[model samples]
Target: MNGTVTELTVPTPEQVARAPKVVLHDHLDGGLRPATILELAREVGHDLPADTAESLARWFAESADSGSLERYLETFDHTVAVMQSAPALTRVAREFVEDLVADGVVYAEVRYAPEQHVEAGLSLDDVVAAVQQGFDEAVAAAETPIVVRQLLTAMRHQARSREIAELAVAWRDRGVAGFDIAGAEAGFPPTRHLDAFEYLQRENSHFTIHAGEAFGLPSIWQALQWCGADRLGHGVRIVDDIEVAEDGTVTLGRLAQYVRDRRVPLELCPASNVQTGAATSIAEHPIGLLTRLRFRVTVNTDNRLMSNTSMTKEMTALVEAFGYTLDDLRWFTINAMKSAFLPFDERLAIIDEVIKPGYAALAAEGV
Candidate 1:
């Protein structure tokens, strides 16, 4: 309440790890295990820069911290290059869910472009089906189990936005929960996909767009007013519209008021934001400011390998930087689950049974 408290008490990793979590913005291609990438690259003769899995993992972490967006995105080329086949997509998706389950995620929505993975002669249907099969396998093998949903993504700089929008609708109720457009948000405005957004609207489909991350308020404005996005993928840049007076009073711009008042979810990724130069550092990040303002803010790992983060790591960073408590962590998880594209009944069941009781256990322990 006092800006960031002078006597900030952060949660321990154990406390954060034990709590149930939810992720709504993780990318399927961005989250492959380092070891699997090494093996897969070798099998496909992709000739990675690093010889060992450990080094390769370190390479991604280091490369992503460059504070340059164009360089940050180039790293995904290698991961996507190897994920052109059904087996590759399936294996990666399975491992993605397995990793989320281990990180105490009770629910996750893993997103990727169907068009990006079809280079191996697979149809759009084949790519989605393969990823879904992998998710089914991993869900079955989870300890307490986690629900996984796919968000079909259309690369914003590409011309296939409308086509991918249709693919997403076709996969609705089967595995894909919604649609998203990711990539270079500055010049490639969400309005560029007006046709796709309109089609998704006609189908009554839910969608989030990559906006207000590397860009600013105009990007967020177009996503909400022009494209009619249901959620924002990394809406961290919406902080551009929040002004704080010297006396500690705060004011929201018209767009910010609409986002907060209308309860449009902002999928905020603090650590990833820093790596991408969206925020200078986690403490200076607007996440605490936004959450304190009662904006529907949630934590996420935009890239597990690149950002070197899990959902637990994201929470730990929040605790260390913002002095977030177990209560704060619970609020973030519920925010993510609530903003998820699942049916109302399914989302409510997860909140009641898994999330509520999980946080309750910590509360009983004097957390």
Candidate 2:
């Protein structure tokens, strides 16, 4: 074994795509296929800025790259507009699962606001059922086993937090896995929906808050302390609490230390962070430091379409930027699977049976 090359070769894009991945923070409205968006737009008589899928895709990327949270979220208007009906919702949901399976995702928790799709005369229950039916159909047709669950989200700036929290509980056993509050974190804080968080907690349910992305530490502090978030969505801004001196010594502030010690998972979306101006570049992302510190850091695709990214692409970028090998990828995958809102036994099962074996095989192959 002397003078031997012991390092595992960096995984190729194909191998990375084939790796078992767990997604915890994806948005359903933000991950639609560009062509599907066009078709759905026509079905709903909705006008889009671009006529073809390619143009529409570019428009989404450019729009989201504007570095303004409000502008970035406006791109969802078209996707949500076309998803108002049951058929549209079902189709999008089915295709979402199909795409995830194709991208080699074994388990995913996709979140969306039920109230956003209710403009077409569908009750909240109907909306949830339609999406669940789509997921069921896709999973049935998949050649490889894949599990997809829903996270019922309420707009933090809205008044239906209680209603949405109740809907999540109603469908907890059906397809919904948990609850969430998502929206701009600046003006509308997670504490605005304290009632929803309290309700979920009273029921012994779990939830994540979209915090620390566009805003700073206060947003994350409020989400965790006041709102009782089980996890922090795009908790990237927690890096503000971390200071590295010029002498190369690192110090963690109280908040950062608490997040690490408490094992709170940070759903870090590298590409999406760059596109949204949360991080300057992939090389400068806090994920590098956070991962080094061994925080419960998990990689994700916050918005697949807008970011124009997939799990493979996200992993590949991290590999190139951070010199990550298959083991590092496995670490992130296990973190995500562990942080998932699924039952502890189910999460452990995936980590042991699916995720570990998948990465181990890749390592054995030296990729």
TM-score of 2: 0.97
* lDDT (10s digit) by residue, model 2, range 1-367: 1111324557887778888999998999999999999998987799999999999999999999987767777899989999999999999999999999999999999999999998979999999999999999999999999989999999988899999999999999999999988887889988888888999999999899999998999999999999899999999999999999999799999999999999999999999999878898899899999998899999999999999999989999998898887778888998999999999999999999999888778767762
lDDT, residue 285, candidate 1: 92
TM-score of 1: 0.96
TM-scores, one per candidate = 0.96, 0.97
lDDT of 1 by residue, 129-204 (tens): 9999999999998888689999999999999999999999998989999999998887899999999999999999
Full-model lDDT for every candidate: 0.88, 0.91
Model 2 stretches astray by more than 4 angstroms? 1-7, 68-70
For model 1, where is the 10-residue window of minimal lDDT?
A: 1-10
Winning model by lDDT = 2
Residue pairs in candidate 2 whose N, alpha carbon or C atoms collide under 3 angstroms: none
How many clashing pairs does model 1 include? 0
Candidate 1 clash pair list: none
